[model samples]
Target: MSELFDRHQAVLPKWLAIYYSDPLEITHGEGRYVWGADGRRYLDFFGGILTTMTAHALPEVTKAIAEQAGKILHTSTVYLSRPMVELAEQVAELSGIPDARVFFTPSGTEANDAALLLATAYRGSNQILAMRNSYHGRSFSAVGITGNKGWAPTSLSPLKTLYVHGGMRSRGPFAHLPDDEFIAACVADLEDVLGQTRPGVAALIAEPVQGIGGFTSPPDGLYAAFREVLDRHGILWIADEVQTGWGRTGDHFWGWQAHAENGPPDLMTFAKGIGNGMSIGGVVARAEIMNCLDSNSISTFGGSPVTMAAGLANVAYLLENDLQGNARQVGGRLIERLRSGCAGLPGVREVRGRGLMIGIELVKPGTDEADPEGAAAVLEAAREGGLLIGKGGGHNTSALRVTPPLSLTQEEADEGAEILLRALGGG
Candidate 1:
């Protein structure tokens, strides 16, 4: 092991996972590529778990951060923050919630936690409904609602979290059904779960695309169907758009738009991409629900000037360049290229996703069993071939996640696809 790896192992928590047998030390990055400590450059397909929204070292974002740092770095929420308010205004307008109120947090976990606090306090209930195979964040409250056991380390929670069905469309009992039937079955499952729960459930939290659960998602209108039931029960719907926000999904600006039959969600939480690589997460809610919390709350570093400046510039860059459109055009071609290449690969179980958020599931050649080892091997091999990717799944982390930056170009997509195919033994 390298000296840095040895030091990391000694200092970091044992449960913190690192990629590859010989872990890479990324020294710097530019555009869609990153340079390792040893001066080797690789195409960054995963984009730092989809956090690098625009690109590596984006000029606009870097300038914004630097400018803000030159003036001020840290000012607690007690003071007036122009950048924070400006970014919040942009987010509130973009968020479809009417009369939306935005509260910034440091990360997606804190955003979800704040949402939970608002829901429970507003409805006066500790009961929450979370979809199976869903992952929200790593906080105590967030993990409590996490249905994937691999990430949920503790069962203890302040709220009564019920695991709802319909997050995963495949490998479940309902996977055999057609899309329409699958929707009906999942709605029925939701109804049954709601029937068993007590009165006054606070909210139902869900990711439009289950990010850490290997980018798996229900049908387009699944959440819309659930919204009808939630409305009847007066349970709020909180869309966790941490990974699927900012047009990453291509088809819709927000993943919730795929299921927009009823309207926007009651509450929404976002993080990851808004500030590019900066730490910025937040919850947006309608005025009434947001004002429900009687006690005053504040996030010390949630809306730091530098991060908010970064967010403003990053969002502006994303909108001005229409990165969402780029994601649609390039990602559509990339998925088709991947599908065509994997058609004859027996170990490939399924190729699924929307826009740039794609998943390639691996299984034993002739069986339906997950092949996590195969996924890991492909990851290492891809790195060896001058490409970087990531893996995740509810089933033993057997799915390869292919979420490149929204600014990924056609040439980069094709090149990365070729490298990935070779890693999968299909090139």
Candidate 2:
């Protein structure tokens, strides 16, 4: 093992996952590429778990961070903060919730935890509805509602979490049905689960696109239909947009918008991509729901000026450049190209996802079983071919995740696609 890898293994938790059998240490990055400690440049397709929303080392974000750091680093929520208030205002205006309020956190786990707190408090119930095969976060509160067995470490939790269906559209009992019928079946399943549960279920939290579950998503309008049932029960809808937010999904600004017939979610949690690399996460909710917490609460490092400045610049650049349009146009072509390339590869089961977030599922040559070893092989081969990617799924970890920065260009997309195709053992 490399010296750094040995040190990391010695210090970090053994369960903390790292990619590849031989982990490569990235030294620096620029644009859509990164350089490893060995001084080799590689195209970055995963964008550091999609946190680098814009290109790597974006000048605007770096400048903002530097400027903010030159000034005061933090003032805490105990005092008034201009950057915090400004970013919160921007988030509230964009959140689509009526009379919205915002609270920032340092990571998505904490953001989801805070959302759970708000929902349970607002509705006076500790029961939460979460989708099966979903990966929320690692915090105790977040993990309590996580349905992915691999990600959920312990059964012990503060809340009683009930697993629901409809997150994973493929490989389910209803997968053979048409989109409309599939949605109906999932809705029926939801109703059935609700019927068995006691009254006052606090809320139903979901990721419109299951991020860690290989970018899986339900049929369009499924959540809208579920909204009707949830409304009757007085349960809030919390959209976990940690991966699918901020136009990463191309067709919609937020993933929940894909299912928007009844309107915006009651509460939304976002983390990844907002700060372009800086640590920033938060929850946006209607004012009434937000104010439900009677006691005082604050996140000490949540809205620090440095991170807020980075977020402000990152969001502004994302909007001004119309990166969402770029994602739509470039990502459309990239997925099509990948689909064509994988058509004849027996080991390649599927090429799926929208916008800059894509996934490639591997399987045993002629079997339907998940081929995690194949996924690992492709990760190693992609690295050897000068491409950086990621992988995730349920406990099997059988799908390769391709979430490049929204600012990815046509040239970069083609280059990364070719590398990935070759790595997949396809021409």
Q: TM-scores of all models?
A: 0.99, 0.99
TM-score of candidate 1 relative to the true fold: 0.99
lDDT of 2 by residue, 226-290 (tens): 99999999999999999999999999899999999999999999998999989999999999999
User: What is the lDDT, from 0 to 100, of the residue 407 in candidate 2?
Assistant: 90
What is the alpha-carbon lDDT of model 2 when measured against the actual structure? Answer: 0.93
The C-alpha lDDT values of all candidates are 0.94, 0.93
251 Cα displacement, candidate 1 (Å): 0.6
Q: Write the per-residue lDDT of candidate 1 for residues 328-398, one digit (tens) a residue.
A: 99999999999999998999999989899999999989999999999999999999999999999999999
TM-score, structure 2 vs. true: 0.99
- Show model 1 residue runs off by greater than 4 Å: none
Residue 336 in model 2: lDDT: 98
